[model samples]
Target chain A: MTHKIDIKNLNLYYDEFHALKSVNMVVGEKNIIALIGPSGCGKSTLLRTINRMNDLIEGVRITGEVFLDGNNIYDPGMDLYELRKRVGMVFQRPNPFAKSVSENVAFGLRVAQFKNKKKIAEIVERSLRAAGLWDELKDKLNRPALDLPLYQQQRLCIARLLAVEPEVILMDEPCSALDPIATMKIEEMMVELKRNYNIIIVTHNMQQAARVSDLCGYMLLGEMIEFNKTSEIFTNPRDKRTQDYITGRFG
Target chain B: MMKLFSEKSIKKALTVIAFSAIAALLLIVVFIILEGLPFIFKVGISDFLFSSEWEPQMGRFGIFPMIIGSLVVTLGSMIVGIPLALSGAIFLSEFVPRWAMRIIKPTIELLAGIPSVVYGFIGVMVLAPLIRDYLGGPGLSILAASIILGIMILPTILSISIDSLKAVPQSYREGAFALGATHWQTIHMAVLPAAKSGIIAGIILGLGRAIGETMAVIMVTGNAVILPKSPLYSVRTLTANIALEMGYATGMHRQSLFATGVILLIIIMVLNYTATIAIRRRVGKK
Candidate 1:
């Protein structure tokens, strides 16, 4: 019932290039909100703004308010480390560390100074299971993470994030690097994950958005063209552009 | 009429050119072993390797002191060099801006071109005297040799490490940041481990240079043939032994210097072999 994240008039720029313009959206609690757009439409930009991951780029400028848990994340007093802990991200490519499978899952805990070896092992097991990779990976926990197949590597990246217990998960083209079967597995995992955590995903596949998300937003050229319930947006979109986009007329 | 060059002929020519370097290495190994092995056998490998005496007239030619000298100096160089090189590489690759690195990287590389003899001269004039006055040993001691050699090998370590650190993909950094890890934590946990193999390779290469170097080490290490008791004590490395005595030596004594070269050669091969195995173990993992 609560809006877990609230963005109002969010504007972002990299040097002189305006990357996101007036992006306003309410991300409801425990729901998977999907952003669908053509490439370079700023869907990924909007997702990065939530976790402040875009701050790493030099010459990036932002003039907006992003409220997370009712606190403005852009406020000067905000701790970046704490904010990032609450908002985890999965990249377009799976980037598991060049470490063993168990170590990859336990890295976040180790950084947080969680010293109990038994607890770390237990949590590693739970996180991998949550990512739906436990059945395939349970016996090979000590094997190098890089040796895993691409799908398992991606799942390991998810388990890495999950181990830190983030409240919001941001995924940018998470399944683009994957084939259909692995994509389906991840899509199902995301839907299951929404029972506990707020999820925001930026994706290119319209079918994926229509299938997995409860709420969907269509964006074009750094602007949000439409936002509605997934069923309503697909069947009875009020915007001519949204209709055109869904019906394969234009981006 | 123009004639076409066949791919097979070009490939064959290039293979021969590529293999010539290895063939030359084989020739050198053959020559050194032919000259030195006889003397080594007569002296007994253990006596040549483990005994400390080195008197040519009295028929004693033990090289144990030189072996210890080389080891101690190389160890000292590593002690001083590895930390500085690693930190410099990390700073260059991670902390410095692109524009700054453009200037700094080339400048760090330029440090490698200074000749060894010039380094030796500088060490004699400055570093040796500094150590002699401050650290309480004769100016020419193992410590002086270590300091100069450490600086000499810094560029090799720095450049290789920088390349390896830079090879780590940007995605790893993003993944670590997303986990709420701080900048230092991301670098320490993610970047360092990913770049470990490269860093160790650089260290091994530097260690090789430290062991093989002769001029600068001899000038500063006082060239004493005693078994060194401490860093403050004077010593003579294997390379220094051959370089200093090869011109005056004859018969078994001359062959003993070549025998020293054989030992140096074996040591390098062992170091390189270990490096290859270590790197293979870390290939895709890093």
Candidate 2:
């Protein structure tokens, strides 16, 4: 299968600290790929490279290539904002804008230049439905998004990403801020969402990577130690480190 | 040393400090009201508040002109000051590099440390002349005072606004960028809305600063007693009015100056109440 995103020898530095060290990875089409690593292992850093979100950080110097749909996103004079539009991201913490429910969902569309009010309203409703938040929020469409409970807020964030029609979604430990039940719901939503868009998730929870992902890449320090099918990585033979990590030996 | 003389003693000491601060504030307010209210009652509230005539020797004290002057000048200063302060705040909080911010923020705040008399001296030497030269009417007009006060209040508004903007989480910016928003769009749509109440507080605080200013205002605003028709016209504000007459006046004139204090106190109380509500709403949201 043609990969949705391909990264080759990706190296990133934040000032003097070497963040991601010559990372190489591939995410298959419409599939869920999880990056499992310890805290500060550069998994989230690798994920941010896909959408050039790292550019927002000061003193970040990146080398190597991240390709989205066979197009090198790190090419010189690239439209960074346009690249971001096609590859959406959800943060570890749910960060809905301090706006009404409908307004939060409609924010991406508005940024993308959708000015017709009726059209925006319809798309807002549809995206919320896809993220499984429509029915819960339909009645309180005008209530501030911050008023929602934590899980609902994350779901609303997902709905916001979906509104821009992104071909791929990057989630950085999306459920880390959520409870176990909320985590389960987000995992289920991810499984369902994979039918429409490619997903790359960086997670600290190995069990979550096992339970929700189709494939897994075990990362250590700043390197990807193993990349394979979830079952093979979790149940069978693999890199000694991946096996050790999954078996609860050491991160 | 026995747990710092026990937590109970510390608590009692703290309570005493807090109560003393409250007691001091109460004393000042009661003193002013007691000194001023008898004059207001003797003159009648309507004549005191609504009439514009003022001759302490003639027993005619209508400060309607000064009240209007204070409002007009304060509003003008905010109009001149807020947009610059707000834009500068946004640049500081969202765009400036860390190294630059370290230098720039302290420099902006230092503007507040300049003595009001120094600002007044500059207004006399530089600003008033420019206004008189260009805008007419002796240069020390409401326009001059507004510009001076506008500059005076910039640090207050800019610093407070920057604080509010900084309080907004980085996650909001990341979320906006992930949706492909340009920096300006993200700041306008996401960051600004989140910092709204704090910005309002900053503006209100700037307004309070402008309204209460005396020395700088007295120097720049020609201190005319007539009702001001335009920004170019010379006008005397409530604070300037009291400062101008309190030295020579006797009896009722002295108390009337205290009455002016009563009016200034009321205006400040209203502004302080509004600012507290805004600050509370901002904190409550988090």
Candidate whose DockQ is highest: 2
lDDT of 1 by residue, B1-286 (tens): 1234577777889999989988998999999999999989999999999999999878899999999999999999998888999999999999999899999999999999999999999999998888889989787998888889989999999999999889899999988988888989999999888989888988998999999999899898998999988899999999999999988999989999999999999999998888787678767464
Chain A (alone) TM-scores for all candidate structures: 0.98, 0.97
Model 2, range A1-251, lDDT digits (tens) per residue?
A: 54688899999999999988889988878889999978888999999999999988889999999888788999997898899899999998899999999999999988988999999999999999999988889999999999899999999999999999899999999999999999999999999999999999999998899898898888888888888898888898468887788888886
lDDT of 2 at B118: 89
* Per-residue alpha-carbon lDDT of candidate 2 for residues B1-286, written as tens digits (9 for 90 to 100): 8887788899999999999999999999999999998999999999999998988889988999999999999988988899889999999998888789889999999999999998888988999889888878888888888888999999999999999898899999999999999999999999999999999999998999999999999998889998987888999999999999988978999999999899999999999999999999998888
lDDT of each: 0.91, 0.92
Candidate maximizing TM-score: 1
Candidate 2 off by > 4 Å: B1-10
> Clash totals for all models, in order?
0, 1
* DockQ values of all predictions: 0.76, 0.88
* Docking quality band of candidate 1, CAPRI definitions: medium
Error of 2 at A114 (Å): 1.8
Q: How much native contact recovery, as a fraction, does model 2 achieve?
A: 0.91
Native-to-model Cα distance after best TM-score fit, residue B283 in candidate 1, in Å: 3.9
